[model samples]
Target chain A: MLEVRGIQTFYGNIQALKSVSLSIREGEIVTLIGANGAGKSTTLMSICGVTPPRHGEILFRGQPIHRLGAEKIVTLGICQVPEGRHIFPQMSVLENLEMGAYLRQDKAAIKADVDEVFERFPILGKRRQQAGGTLSGGEQQMLAISRALLARPTLLLLDEPSLGLAPLIIKQIFEIIRKINAESNTTVFLVEQNANQALKIAHRGYVMENGAITLEDRADNLLSNEEVKKAYLGI
Target chain B: MDSEYFFELLCGGLVKGSIYALIALGYTMVYGIIQLINFAHGEIYMIGAFVAFIVSGVLTLTGYGGPTVLLLAAVIAIIYAAAYGYTLEKIAYRPLRAAPRLSPLISAIGASIFLTNYVQLAQTPDFLPFPELITDFDFMEPFSRYVSSVDLVILVVTTLTMIALTVLIKYTRVGKAMRATQQDAVMARLVGINVDRVISATFIIGSALAAIAGVLIASRTGQINSAIGFMAGIKAFTAAVLGGIGNIPGAVLGGLVLGIAETLGAGYISSAYEDVFAFGLLVLILVLRPAGLLGKAVKQKV
Candidate 1:
């Protein structure tokens, strides 16, 4: 339930998202695999209204949200767990969770969801009183996801959750992502550098180069494709 | 010199430093949370003194019978100052929170200038007398030639306020939120902090402390005017920066150090250039420790 068409985003005069387009449907895990500076983060940023697209439309469930502010877009059930986790470092894990549900009015549901986050990431529960900055990279990543989940958004934007984690932790994180999508029917728009893990979880995938979607296909077929093998899968 | 003379000097400096620390707390708290200096804070102190001026005058004029009337006056002054600080934040700083860096700062300067001029117009730019209840000009000292009961009262009041602020930032939930917000405003916002509101509350608390300092200083000196805020504000800001601009205890340490230095500089160095001693200390200390004495350095990775 998302649509982005011909969006142009810029930092000063340098265009980051150059006339890009993409879409995602409900209950689907869509992946965008790209190298550094390929504008993957910018695409997510544009959708979440952190960097409002200069020349495009972003529709979530057929409502225009391109003009909305970042927090307003969050209220519309679109949440972006930014690159680098961006967890409030000085806040405790509990306080970070509280902030994630900032826009929600239901205090009871919020508390329940917080419990669920603590249940899923019991490490966070054990360290609830400690500042988020003190958590390890893997734990911080888990806290970040749990925090975004606290928003109770229909769509979750994950950018590089596995960036600095060990292989085992990355595997566990990916498995959890799968579990979340299956259980909650949440639409996940994931951007990643690890094409293999991303492709395995994604229903459909897009390969981006220099701010444009260069290839789009079913994850399995793309994994077996010769160019995909050579360029991304390393098969 | 006798221990009493040295003890008295120490007490006197410590007392004045406590007032500086109280005012410095406001500067440091606002700076800690938003990294923005609320320049109008000094005016909040000025306003608090006026609030005490009005409240205590009325209380004593009505023959409010109690030996504890001075304490009551202090409490009223604190509340009035907090309200003034909160209002200033809501009106001047809150609206410009989203504006660029320089905008809110300018607004703060504007607020400072506006209040200075406003208080001047309202109170008539003349030096006003502090309330006499706490001053007690009738009582002369024993074995003390320079230090008065007025100075002693000021010391007591200022010391107590600083201790209260120390307990606050160290132990309170809201204080934790303030530190978090100060550390990272964007992340704090994402986590659901109404940062603007927290900042306003900080201003309120800080200004309240400053009001205590203002009242104590006014009562001790027995002369105040619109121009008084300029010197007090500058010295207090210097104290904040000296102890590490964002550290609360640092401000107190800085204030005490600065007060002693200034007093000594006036007595032994040059009374006409007492302010130069404060400025010189600030510059010298900051040059050595860019973050000030108690400030920890921050590292950001790109």
Candidate 2:
């Protein structure tokens, strides 16, 4: 339940996103696949108001979110798992997860949600007391997801959860994403460079180039496309 | 000097050293999380002593009983001073959280100046007398020692405060949040830290410590003025720098070392250049170790 239309974003004088538009419906996983500097991360940032679109409209569940601050956006049930895992390095895994529900009241629901995250990523339960910085790349990726999950977001935005992760860990993360969506029906908007893995799970996806949405198709259809293979799959 | 006189001076230095440790605690704690120097913290100390002095005067006028009553009055004054410190952070520091570090530093200095002038107007530019809470006891006199009851109280109170603060930071939820926010503000925000609240709490705690030091110092020296904080703040800041600006245990060690060095230098050499020796030691330590005796030198990533 997120909408984006004709948004332009900038990093000072350099334009990052130019006339980019895409949408994610309720309870679906949507991916934006791109090469480096293709405005994929910029698109997500614009949606979450980290860098508000200079000229565009973004709607989260029919409410205008483009104007809200970063903290306020999360209050509306839109959370982003930023690129680089960005875990509070000195904090324990449990503390990092607690931060995800910083805005939530009702202690019971928060506790239940934390338990659900630990259940999904059982390894985290074992090392909940360990500092986040001590976690391996793959473990840190799980921590990031569990952290985002703690927020209980209606729309969870993940930016490259597989970066710096091993192949086995990447597969595990994708599987967890599937389970999370299947079980919780949380709307997912993922930006990724791993085109094949992303297309496998994304219901519908957009191929972005130079800040524009150049291609849009069903996940399987785009996975088999010749041009998509040449540019992204390298097949 | 004889061994007894030497021991006497050691105790004297230790008493003043505790005050420096208390004040430097405020500086280091603020620097630890927000990376702010909190230049205004010294003024918070001044304000706290002033509150204690004013309250003591009122109490004496109303016939509140001796030293015990004065101690209770000082404690109440400390609470009031902490409220001032909390308000200072909320009103002055928190708004600049997203602003550049320089902006907050400038604001802290401005706050320092503002508080100094405000107190100067409320009290007086001249030295105001601190209540003589325990002058009659003279604890060290039985041993024919030079130390007074005031010196004893300062050492005891300062030690207790430091131990309490160390415990609070190590074993508390707020402590976890503070360290979390310190490591990564953005990540802390994502996890729901209310970074602003943690920062405010930190400032409040720091200011409270500084204020206690102020009250103790005023009582020990017999008088204080608006400008008293400036000299004490500089010495405490030097201690903070010597101990490593952001390291907690380092602050106490630095303060103690600087206090001894200053006390010994003034006793043996010119008293006018007492400050020079304190700061010179700070510069020398910073140049040699950069991290002080107890601090770990973090190898910077290239």
Candidate 3:
């Protein structure tokens, strides 16, 4: 479980996140839907301590993690598949996956986890020796997710997993995301512009606008809400 | 010219190229990881030579000489150089990690100047003779007349070190972390890798390689001074750029090519224009292939 309270994040003079707060209980898929520049990615980054909130506290499993370094935050079982699928371009797929388990010393478990990732994304297994950058956009996204999964994270944060992908690939990716949550009971905090696909799979959802969370409701309720349908669902 | 004479020149070129390869690795590796040119790297090589010079002198005075003492002195010099590299990164480069790119570059140049002067002040400005270590053996007596034991030593040491480095980067966990950091620092940190430590390790490994090169070059040339690093550093930097600055194998190839070109140019054309040949190759490479021979054209994803 995670709790974020009154976090304000800034990018120099511009305030990117204003008192943004949200929570995710264990074993739930929570998606944050927003338009461009809605601070969805910023919220995930702040929780990961990449861009720490200047005025808020983030607690993971009842422990304060807002002040820790990004690397330390990862060791505490949180991983992010960053926007744009920032896979190590020159490294092979297997090496990228190895990097996911960087902090773990248990070699046997790491190997088994890698096997699981290969099972989930068979194309990644096929291209295990190929450089990450050489993969297709959808394949790269799969690699990014597979890499994060190797870390054995308790909470996985996915930022725009469907960005720059075909609709069919997006559908497959969302299906995988759902499969991951359902089978492993993994807590997922997804940030997305594709509200329709995201809310359909999410147990709960939040609508962000102008760096603030403007609405929070159950996924089905938000899907039927007239204002939500007008502003985000495009009904 | 006789075939033996040409062979001699070829051997000499290889020896020189091996030295350049070692120094170029330092330049290329550091630049690859941090995107900092690390102008101070050449000075680290200079210090390594000086350390070996002092250690050899002490060893001789204490009645210790020969191959064992020589090897011991080289080891000490390498350890000292690695330490200097660690401290230099911590002091000169770490603080400027988040600053604008130009800041660390300027700081690196400043560090280079400070190190060069520090040596000049601490020791002497005069060119001191490097102790005779491995010159006694005739390593290539059966095969070639011109190649000596020192040349053999340089080639062997360089080859072994490069192989070790390749293995370290390819098969090791830490090396994977380094490659990850090089590709994306933020993502690397997100995976629980200490980016600072990886950067520091790069500096340490690069500096150690340069240290061995300095000792070998000093032995081959028979003398060294504080200003030696200036020309060597520039040439090695040129070699790194020539081979594609961030590419490791490219650095070695560039170094060997530069060394052969310079040596052959001097032997065939004129000695006075030897440095010109090296610089000319650099310009030619930049004009023809700006990314260096092995450097790939990186596409900027917007």
Interface Cα root-mean-square deviation for all models: 3.8, 3.7, 2.1
Q: Candidate 3 overall Cα lDDT vs. reference? A: 0.92
- Please state the CAPRI-style docking class of candidate 2: acceptable
Whose TM-score is greatest here? 3
Highest DockQ, which number?
A: 3
Best of the candidates, lDDT = 3
Task: Please give the range of 10 consecutive residues that has the lowest summed lDDT in model 1 chain B.
Answer: B135-144
Clashing pairs in 1: A99-B191, A99-B192
Q: For residue B170, what is the lDDT in candidate 2?
A: 68
Q: Which is better, 1 or 2, measured by DockQ?
A: 2
Which digits, one per residue and each the tens of the lDDT, describe model 3 over residues A1-235? Answer: 8999989999877999998889999999999999999999999999999899889899999999999999999988899999999988888889989898888899999999988888878888999998888889999999899889888888999999999999999999999999989998889999999999999999999999999999999999999989989998899
- What pairs collide in candidate 3? none
- lDDT for predicted candidate 1 compared with the true structure: 0.82
> Per-residue lDDT of B1-302 in model 1, one digit per residue for the tens?
57665566666667677778888989998988877888888888888777777777788889883336667877888988888888888888788766787988999999999999998998778888876666444555563455677776776667776677667755565665676678776655554456667788898899888888877787777667886777788889999999999887788888889888777676665679988988999999988998898886433322
DockQ of each: 0.28, 0.34, 0.68
